[model samples]
Structures are given as structure tokens and as C-alpha cells.
Target: MRLFFHTISARKKLVFLLALLVLPGGCSRHKSPRYLYGSNCGICHHGGEGMAGSVPPLSGRIDRIAATPEGRVYLASVLMNGVSGPIRAAGVPYRAEMPLFRYLSDEEAATILSWLSQQGETKPAPTITREDIAAARAHRISAGDVADMRAKLDLKHPLP
Candidate 1:
């Protein structure tokens, strides 16, 4: 090891050390909504379950919810405006304070929601689009409004 180090020029040694550092970061980088979700949402959502679960469990409910036009818009509203106060999920109640992620671009919001809807099952899920996010943004409801929306959403069953 000492002999190999001595044989290399200073520039080569620096290059080798830099490559060692950069490779792991490059390889570890997460793509698309995984990064968006993990970085922005993974903390409390814990893989998207409020446990009473992010905003409710992504385990099975997301695909069901996204199947409906109203549900899709509600979801986009939650993401853009966020919801506070108490809510029930999976039969239990949770009072998490979700913050608005309005800073995300329309494309990024669509990507995140699309990823969320696809989580935890093999069933094909509907895709959220930039247009969906944009429309939600246009409405600009408050957190209280979304909190009230939780009840009407009827998230427990898939809507026709």
C-alpha cells in the first residue's frame, strides 16, 4: 500500500481520492419522486402511512383514491395547500400538521403524486399530471378547508 501510494503522482492521488468520494454519492443518488418523497415527506409519513397513518396509508388507499376525479383533485389540493388539524385514517385518528409543498414545480408535484399513487401494490394506478397540479394550485384553498375535506373524501372505499 505504501509503495503504491509513493509511486503515484500527487495529482493522481488527489484524483483517486476524489473518485472514491464522488462515486458513492453518485451511486446513492435517488431519482424522481423517490427523492422528492423521501427528502420532503418520509419523516412523519413513514412510507405514506399516517398509521392513523403522510396523509393516510399509501399501502392500498392511494390507488383507490386516485381512481376518482374528485379524489385526485383533493390530493393535489392537499399537496399544494397542505392540511392541518385532526383527521382519521384506517379507522384511527391522527392530528398531523402537514405543510404546503407549493414550492415544487407543477411537473415535480405531478411526479410526486404519481409515485405516491403507485406505492405498495401491483395494481395499475392512475397518473397525476402537471395539469392536475396546476388546476389545484389555481383554487388555492386553506389548510382548514382541506381538513374539512378529509371527511367528504371517503377515503376508506374506492369511489365509482
Candidate 2:
């Protein structure tokens, strides 16, 4: 009886361990930007490479886009509100609806953007801060508005 009880206890422990590994948010509250990206953006963006001509990739583009003040606003707004409709990245056209991540905190959004900026071979990318995200959140806008905002930006970088 004692041995059987011990075995059951061990099995329970194993199950608990597995749950921590497989569950969302994992075992910690503060997740790394890479981990955050994997759980959130990686599903569609696929390591920032994107999905063919549908979803636009972040590599080579985020760094340049985040460099300017207006571009930074666009990035923040996109995260808060999401964006849909047609857009171009690396000269390729993309038409898709990027879901909103409004639930993410300002710090989390900023960190994710900063991580994206470092992707691909490009000049040093600017560090997006929580303040930038907060500023964008100050004025809540719809996803369609964000799409319109993207239309006005002068993002002319050619992706390789």
C-alpha cells in the first residue's frame, strides 16, 4: 500500500510538471521578448519571415520603421489597435488583418517591438519604450485607422 501511494504521488508530480511546461504564460509572469514573440506573433509571422505574400514580415522593416517618430507612432498604434487591408513590405504587397494585441501591457509591446527591430541584417534599430506605447494608447483608434496611417508613412526600405 505504501509503495502504491508513493507511485501515485510521483505520477501527480510528473503531471504537474508537464502542465507548467505546456500551459500558456508558462511558469513565469515576466516572459522574454523572444518567448512572447513566439507565443503571440510567431504563429502567423513565422519567426518574422511572415507567410508568403499574405502576412508582411517584420525583418528589415521594423528597424527602419521604428527609427522615426511618426513611424514609432504607427508601430505602437498597430499593436494597440491592429491593422487590416493592403500594405507593402520589402516592395511586396500584402493584404491581411493583423489582430490586435491590446491586452499586452505597454512594457510588453515595447519589448516586442524592440526585439523585432533587431531582426535581419540592418543598421542599429531604435529601442521602443513603454512611453511610446502609452502615447499611442492615449488616443484609442480602430484597426482600419491604423491601416490608413500606414498609407501615409514614407517607409521606402528595400527588403533583401
Candidate 3:
């Protein structure tokens, strides 16, 4: 009887250890910065009015922006920082100021950008790279960069 009890106890302990190893601690597993965006940013950026401005629809913007190098670079910069003032989408003008989100890490930025690029928007699939991210970062860009980019694009009144 003693031998059988010990064996069962050992088996129970082993199972408990395995469970601990596989199951991460509470809440920490989902605490990533990406989670912040999905839960919080998505609250508004998804389909609702985000920050008083209709969040730029991410559906088709991804493909339209990823097809060209300039577009990809432009998007990465916008994500790292934010854009404000007048901007346009699908030819419609939007006038709003997008708050900058600088808390995201480089990897997080890359992931968000890649996901945005592929969000059922583009046809061939977006091909955003870390290199493109670096280039966009190098643009020394900021919310203010929108002014210059818009001027170059001849967007006298771009949308948000």
C-alpha cells in the first residue's frame, strides 16, 4: 500500500509540474504592446470613431500603400509617429489630428505594419520589411512630416 501511494503521489507531482511549465502565469501572457493596440486602439481604429476622427479605414489602405516603396515607407513612418492635419483617403478628404503612438517597440511597429499591409487590402500580399521600417525611421519624420509629404503629393488638404 505504501509503495502504491508513493507512486501515485509522484505521478501527481509530475503532472502538476508539467502543467505549470505549459501554462503561463496569469495576465502576463497577453500583456504585450500589440495587445494594447488590439484591445484599446482597435476599439476606435477598427470601425468606430477613434479620437473624434473616423479612424482611417485600414481595409484597402494596406494594399494601396504597400504596392510601392514610397507608400510602404510612408506608412511605417506614420505608425511610429502619428499624422495630423488634412489627409485624404480613396480621394475623400479628412481633417483630423491623429495622436502619435510612440510607445510601440521596433518589433511591434514591424508587426503592426506587416499586419496592416496584409489586412485583406492588397492583392499580392504586402511585403513590408524591417529595412523599410529603418528607412522610414531614418526619414527623421514626425507628425510634422505629414506637412512636407502632403505638399509633395500636392495634397493641399489631406485627410486624417
Candidate 4:
């Protein structure tokens, strides 16, 4: 009888400890998609004369990026490698020259992309994959692509 009670108590203690370990990660503030964006992308993307006019608003961009193959390609590439010119999301142009974060992990990029896609805006969500980031990184991203994208929006500073 005592052995049975000890066994059950031990199981309960193990279960409790496991829950304690996992719960913090589940409830973490930065784990949230919105919070992640606000921390990372929002650094350069949030509004201002410098950012508002320069950065395309993220709130309504999912639909635009999902509208066509070219848009998705451009969107993913821009996030992976970064851009130096005007960018237009959903026909609305933003002039900020987004720089590359070459060190962002693939999982982090995917999380941000998935968050942007499901943001519940007019544009359909994009189906960006880890493979896409890998491919973008492998390719020779060009200055011309940047110039073309820049032409689509108004920028705060003139391109050098």
C-alpha cells in the first residue's frame, strides 16, 4: 500500500515539473506573432515621416503580396536578402530601403512570414516556405531588382 502511494506521488511530481518547464515557453510574450513583428520588423516598419512614407504599412499587405507569383517572390526575397529601393505592397508603394538581416534564422523568418500572411487583412496570405528562404539566399540578388522596387514607392532619402 505504501509503495503504491509513493509511485503515484512520484508520477504526479514528475508531471507537475514538466508542466512548469513548458508553461513559460507557451506563455512567453515574445513568442507571440504580433509581438515578434513589433520587435523585429517593426523596428524599420512602424510609422513615422521616415518610416510611414518610407515603409509600406504591414497591416494591409498580406493581400497584396499574395495576389501574384511575382509579389510573393519579391516579398520573400526582400525579407531574406533585403532591398535598397522603393517597395510596393498591394500597389501601395513605400520608399524605405530595407536592409538585409543575413543572420536571421530560417525558422524566425518563417514565423514572421506566416504572421504577415495570417494577419487577417484584404490580401490573401502567402505560402512562404523554408525552402524559399534557402533559395533566395543562394541566388544572386541584384541591384536592378532593388531599383525596380524602389520605383514603385516614394523614399525618404535619394538612392546613392
lDDT tens digits, residues 52-102, model 3?
A: 345556655665666666667667767666787776665565674666555
> All predictions: root-mean-square deviation over Cα?
4.9, 4.7, 6.2, 7.2
The sequence of per-residue lDDT tens digits that candidate 4 reaches over residues 35-115 is 666667878776211254556666655544545555555566777667775555445566556777556666666667767
Clashing pairs in 3: 86-158, 86-159, 87-158, 87-159, 88-159, 94-159
Q: Which candidate is the best by TM-score?
A: 2
- Minimal lDDT window, size 10, model 2: 151-160
Better of 2 and 4 by TM-score: 2
TM values, all candidates: 0.71, 0.77, 0.63, 0.61
Against the true structure, candidate 4 has what lDDT?
Answer: 0.61
lDDT by residue (1-160, candidate 2, tens digit) is: 5575576777787786788777766533468889888888899998888988788888778877887788888899998889988887777888869988988889889989989988845566688899999988887888888988888775442222
Better of 2 and 3 by lDDT: 2
- The residue-level lDDT of candidate 2 at 126 comes to 83
Model 3 is weakest, by summed lDDT over 10 consecutive residues, at 151-160
Number of the top-ranking candidate, with lDDT as the measure? 2
Runs of candidate 1 exceeding 4 Å displacement? 1-30, 51-56, 155-160
RMSD of 1: 4.9
